[model samples]
Target chain A: MAREKFQTLTEQMFYILLALQEERCGADVMALVAQITQNRVAIGPGTLYNLLEDFLAAGMIVQTKTEGRRRSYTLTQQGRDRLLMEKQRLERMLSDYRHMTAGTEKNQRDTAG
Target chain B: MKRKFEFNLYAPFQYQDLQDHLEKMAGRGWELEKAGYRLFTYRAAPPATVRYAMAFRPEVGWMDQLPTQGQEIYADYCRDAGWELAATWSRFPQVQFYRSRKQYPVPLETDLTSRWRVTAQWMETRFVDPLRGDVAIGCFFAIFLAIVLTIFLAQEEFAPPLFAMCAAADVLMILLVLNQLVVLVDAQRWLQQAKRAAEEGSPGPGGRMSLPWKLTTGLLIAAGAATLAVYVTNATADFGFLAPVRIAGAVLVFYITLFAAFRFRDLLRKRGGSPHWKWIVFTLVATLLALLSVELWDWFTDF
Candidate 1:
């Protein structure tokens, strides 16, 4: 599961999506993501708002409500599809690669010899 | 200490929107140092800033001109509760003088028809982009997105290609415009600066923008005409030829919009048509007739 997740995730992109998947608001998403990241990434309001603003403009996310002078966001059908596609690609690669390498170094040497 | 700007109102304003004007004041190197009720101080920046200040605000009038008694009262009321009035004079009402006389700012170009002749001229001339760097950057980004869209019609990778590109472009443009707008809020700052500059007088302020700007405008107009002539003669439409067309268009549009808006709004407030309009119209008609005759001759002679 970890390998599959790691294979598909873009560090910033994944965290943003993960944050939004739960909170359902823009400010909340930013806040939750900041906490989870331990403040390593301090995105300014413009940058964060810009990204979410872009997402909403593109219809990748829908704004649910206003939270204390901030808006909330959740993934739309398109965004969900995109996230799932990335996950499936990673999952497929993991299962297939493991099967092919199942014999390991010992099996390869004996079989070749 | 560096030279600073100061605003002096010979007459008072009623709904004086200083921030909006000042934000429009700075260009290139000049920036706001301090702003108050009716005085704005710009810290003399590098030479470029001064030049930019000269170029940008040159003489952008407030609401096109000074306010009348009725409008003045209305604007004063519009002022924040704590704001104070600076100086007022009724004799030279609507007459604002730059503290320092750097040659008068070049009047902006005033043509906006998207004609091929104009585009050719724009390409021929060197145009200093009126927009600031950040604004230019945002514009470039929009162009970049367009380029990307041209290459990638649509695939989920960039998904809804046109829509996504357009969305990003629009949002970025808004952000860019807003960023500039916030700075524009310095009207009070600029007015203060301009007023102070007026009071202190221009540093080496003997220079004037009018002469140079006028010549440049004339040159641009001539270049546009020449370009149009050349294109008509050559009968080809290419990048090399069309570059000047854009500048010419920009200059023409910028000046026309600035002056028209200024004059029209001012007329409405002053309740008197600007005397300058008569001269301008006369000059414009004469020039047009000359051009038309020349064109008619060329058609007959094919030169």
Candidate 2:
């Protein structure tokens, strides 16, 4: 099934928004994503270019400044809200993991005891 | 500087092979100068290792010329990332060719989903739909030819020359159908593989030089040669030795007119001319030229 546009953020999209929490250029966003993820997540230049365009169109990111071809952007309120929503969704998943595994461990301990 | 021309029929989905081929040429001291319909021109340059990247801008349409305002901005983005605009196919300006000497950790398009979506669009627009249309037309032609041949046989009016000509046409149509089918299958397979890769967040299954595409091109050439051979061989006394010559002349005239039309469009685009009315002008001029040529040929033959 086709996904609704930007309903849920991919890892790259989430990190891109996280990077734009501070006013950063497109290249800076790419660099920051890789750095903050310890090289685990890297955004290609073409992908970064496209995501920035999409973000601008969606009103999730506002262009802070333009230096010739290089443009800087920071997250809008909507973008920030979306980022927070994604974080909460991920935390919920982690909590579910802990709860489910906690029951399994408790059962094993009870049986052993 | 020395120059070389080569036939390049690789579809947009096979961009990996296209990029690698260009890079290899660059390593051999040749740089791509132009890309046209199934043709690439390379110019001798200093030997260097270059990485070629392909990207598509969906907004760019068929009629738009190179480096439209939007495309210029897109190129600027690539420039900032160390990629230089190398060349673009005049017919499809959406497919941008970028080259860089600076090494990057990843390819131009890193996101598998984005790459898949772009490539899928190209595959649909550029290859699959077009080939499907071609195959459908070929089928219709084959059916029409079969009906005509059956009627001729039933009426006992089929001449040896006509039969041979029909046979030649059937062979050509069959070859065309096969060629289109081969490419269509290859495109569908690649699209499926790409979709799976995108889902897995893995590197795309980049297409290589497909043997099927090479065979398709070869079959097309063979079909043309066979058709010409049939025309030459079946030049009977009633058909006249000049029949083949007349057909060749007509073919040449039409081919020249079509070539002129494309060249005019390309020239107009290069001059920043509007594409809105170019098609209208091209059709009128090409039809007039073709009709005039046919009339002239008739008058000359009578004279």
Q: Pick the candidate with the highest lDDT.
A: 2
Off by over 4 Å in 2: A34-40, A64-70, A90-113, B102-105, B125-135, B146-165, B188-216, B232-256, B270-275, B282-303
> Model 2: what TM-score?
0.78
Give the per-residue lDDT digits (tens) of candidate 2, residues B48-118: 98899888776665666656766776676577668888888765767878899976535677677766766
Candidate 2 lDDT tens digits, A11-52:
888999999999998777877888889989877777887778
By TM-score, the best candidate is: 2
Task: Give every collision pair in model 2.
Answer: none
**Candidate 1 chain B, run of 10 with poorest lDDT:** B107-116
In model 2, the Cα lDDT at residue A18 comes to: 96
- For candidate 1, write residues A1-113 as lDDT tens digits: 11221234344455566667654654455457668889764433223433454457667678787544445678888777767877788789998998878879569889899
| Position B287, candidate 1: lDDT | 62
